[model samples]
Target chain A: MKLKEIAHSRTGDKGNISNISLIVYDQKNYDLILEKVTPERVKAWFSESVFGEVIRYELPNLGALNFVMYDALSGGVTRSLSVDKHGKSFSSALLEMEI
Target chain B: MKKIRIGAGAGYGGDRIEPAIELMEKGDLNYIIFECLAERTIAIAQEEKLKDPTKGYNGLLEYRMRKVLPLCKEKGIKVVTNMGAANPESAVRVILNLAEELNIKGLKVAAVLGDDISQSIENYMHLEVLELKNPLESIREKIVSANVYLGIEGIVEALENGADIVVTGRCADPALVLAPLVHEFGWSESQLDLRGCGILAGHLLECAGQITGGYFADPGYKEVPDLWKLGFPIAEVSETGDILIEKVDGSGGLITTATCTEQLLYEIHDPSTYITPDGIADYTAITMEQVAKDKVCIKGGKGRVRPETLKVSIGYKDSFIGEGEMSYGGSNALAKAQLAAEIIRNRLPIIGCEVDELRIEYVGFNSLYGTKIGEVLNREHTLGEVRLRVSGRTKTRAMAQMIANEVEALYTNGPSGGGGAMQSVKEVVAIGSIFIPRSDIHVNITYKEV
Candidate 1:
């Protein structure tokens, strides 16, 4: 199943950085997601868009994980020529990740 | 102390006003806060301020204030907002006159000033930019506005002085909601733990309808009921920082644990060290439970002392962005779009129009993710229509307009069945973050009564 089936996400941006918070619907899937969804995996998943390092923060208490990507947003909102400058749709794109 | 009901009037500058009206009328709220400034909006507002000294606040300030002031007067609810954008004093004057026009008596409005550091930005030029790690002098000439992200000090002072409405330029978005909590509950500046919870409530409620399921509906998967009539959120916060998140009864959307969890992480970077003027809030320290229908209880968030330096957003003229789009439908739509993109790519340099950065993609196919990622995701489906989008950033507005003109020319010059051509040129107001000593920023509250 895709990550969207078991989990959901929200994308937030600041400067050239973008952060996505991935929350699982069930706590039972937390361990699996935590093990599979690494910083490296997420950075690679957003291959063309994310050029910077990806950092992950764990929130097992709430059955969620946060992935922060530096040098994202192409050149941040004002500078990025992207149609989705803030990378708001990056949340839905991350949901395409297979689990 | 009694539990205070605070409702988020708006999330951003151009958000829906009807929901805010509903929140004010239906929700028995003590306070309604409208957080209007975004990262780049203050700079845009600054640009307007340069033209007209009396302007530069939120464009919808008059409309929003006119609609809500009557309700606030009727219900005896106080108002707080950052709608003052680049000029809060002028905004306060506007509000004061508005109150007089509406015949609302004895309305005390306060303007919280001192965030605009553009005049004295040179004094801090020796400081290094936080994100770029470069000296502040790097882009010194391009600096248009520099406003610090203030905390609750100004608003607290305004409330303490019995101001019914508090207007500010740029403070932390959460401060609009947090200041009232502090003033009503009498949380001292030293109470980091209690203030942390208050800030937490501010964070959750800052985005208005978002917590009440504005952005969480996925349909057939994560469904939100009556999303079109989505109700704004109301935070019932106790003195100890215990919060019950709910909406007015019969309002649309919901407040489940799922919705709350999503908002908890929205726009947040480090869950453990989310910085604010008050303290470093540990967002992960809290747990959310669905205590009732359309209600969630948030408890237990920890915090440490705030950083001595405050965060300042420096807005500068970045560049001009030009985007042009043309849709191709009927047979061979994808092929025609590909051809159109190729022609524009080959035609640009030949036309002697250069840009700093360029991206040409097929909408409905690969505009979001690149062609490679789109292929991996949408390989099974054959596209019936493709919208060719050509976007570029350039130093000059004319060059940006030419970039858009090139796409519009494709109607007769390149591909057939090209329709609905849209072109837009935008002057980018880029923002950068820097820090200044808390002492350097002197927040003041100026009051005006009607």
Candidate 2:
């Protein structure tokens, strides 16, 4: 099953950085989930041209996944308030990843 | 000159409205601030959004907003809040609908966006700025959400743009009120002393009614009175950063030095290292006085330099978990449950599955209070229950299924087994933090005329 098809996810704002959590439907597919889902894969899925860092968290009890992407906010954190940077919100196509 | 009295509410999660409104009604307050996010609350918010996208914003409880917004609009008080969890624009849409329903005019609602980072996590990890003790490991696949608790500068920009009701995503709670105070007082961002003062003021009043009497009630705790109508806290911050922690007159609870000290000590590990997105506040220099029945005047808080690294919260995919429970009768019930958990642990691996954390709790035998009691006769052993819990990072639904299946097998193969068997196990996910350098992290504030 696709990641988006099976997991429940949500995103938050902090300039270019965003947090995403996903819950798998079946426990048996966890290893398959991890094997297919990697930081490099996620980075490629989300950004057209990679810039900054991606951090992840593993919560066993909640059956969920969390990701922190930094410098995604254009101009990095310092220019988070400038108007030119606000237009760079995360693309919805990247949000439709299947892993 | 008229005093621009701004009021900010405090509390963990979404419990800041009633008291904020009460203070607005009685104290002639000009601005109201509400703090409603924490670590656990964020988890809960994510869970709610999973059920329904619109339900994610926990602070938009109508009961809380209904009591306060109308009055603030009538009194010409501008309201600002970070109650906008996953969806600030949707929250703003709701507030504007409320304004229309109330027949209130010229209520401009603006949503401060661009903080959603769920899509760009991978790119962030590659920057080499995030310092993690462990290299991106197995958990990197489990990340569900990431949001940096932002500073108050964004709120200042929104206010400058003439937005009366400024709604934001995840701003540092204390900055909600401090931003307005900084703007109204014309305090410069470079004034470390003034900024530190604002941080101190925000800290004191952040946990609405907490400094007064929400969590730590004195010896007369029972007589605190009308807790249902407990007022949220309001910070009367000055240009110098001194704040008066008070509530609406005749509101429930008392504000005293003892209460203020108790609140200050809440969740505080080190008094000298109270940090916020705005700056680091020094609680060591704080002094509190019971200025009135419901007023505690706080002053003399100093500050130091902020850290060059920004704290980052990251999560990744782990394992799945499933749990169940069973009850037993008779005196030897407690011992049987203990043996059962051990048997399952030893037996599960044999069947090709590994368990990470396995625990069996004796519900009726002092499990919660941290007291241990031995299995004995003669003493009345009221109904007892055992909760078998297990966790693993492996892909083993059968492990959980087998544990449950074996629990039923204990009815015949195990000793003194009379009760029914239940199965419970959960998947494991890892959560850790990485620090991003100041030079690597970027933030910008701009103005958009409405």
Residue range with the least summed lDDT across 10 consecutive positions in model 2 chain B: B369-378
- Per-residue lDDT of B21-90 in model 1, one digit per residue for the tens? 9989989999999999989999999999999999999999999999999998899899999999999999
Superposition error at B112 for model 1 (Å): 0.2
Model 1: how far residue B326 lies from native, Å: 1.1
DockQ of 1: 0.77
User: Could you give candidate 2's per-residue lDDT for residues B1-450 as a string of tens digits?
Assistant: 223456656465656455676677776877777677654345445556768887667555455666766886788777777676666766776776676777777777777764445565665654332323455443456565566667776788888877777777666776877788778888775777667777766766777766666654323222455677776666677767777877777777767665565455443334556687777876766666668787877777666666666555554434444443455555567676667667766877787666544444455543321121213211455545543332232356766565556666767766474465566554433334555554544444332222
Best model number under TM-score? 1
List residue ranges in candidate 2 displaced over 4 A.
Answer: A1-99, B1-10, B40-56, B59-67, B126-132, B136-138, B218-223, B325-353, B363-431, B437-450
Q: Residue-wise lDDT of candidate 2 within A2-75, one digit each (tens)? A: 45455434433343455444445455655665667676776755553236677665544334445556655433
Docking class of 1: medium
Interface RMSD of 1: 1.2
Question: What TM-scores do the predictions have?
Answer: 0.98, 0.67
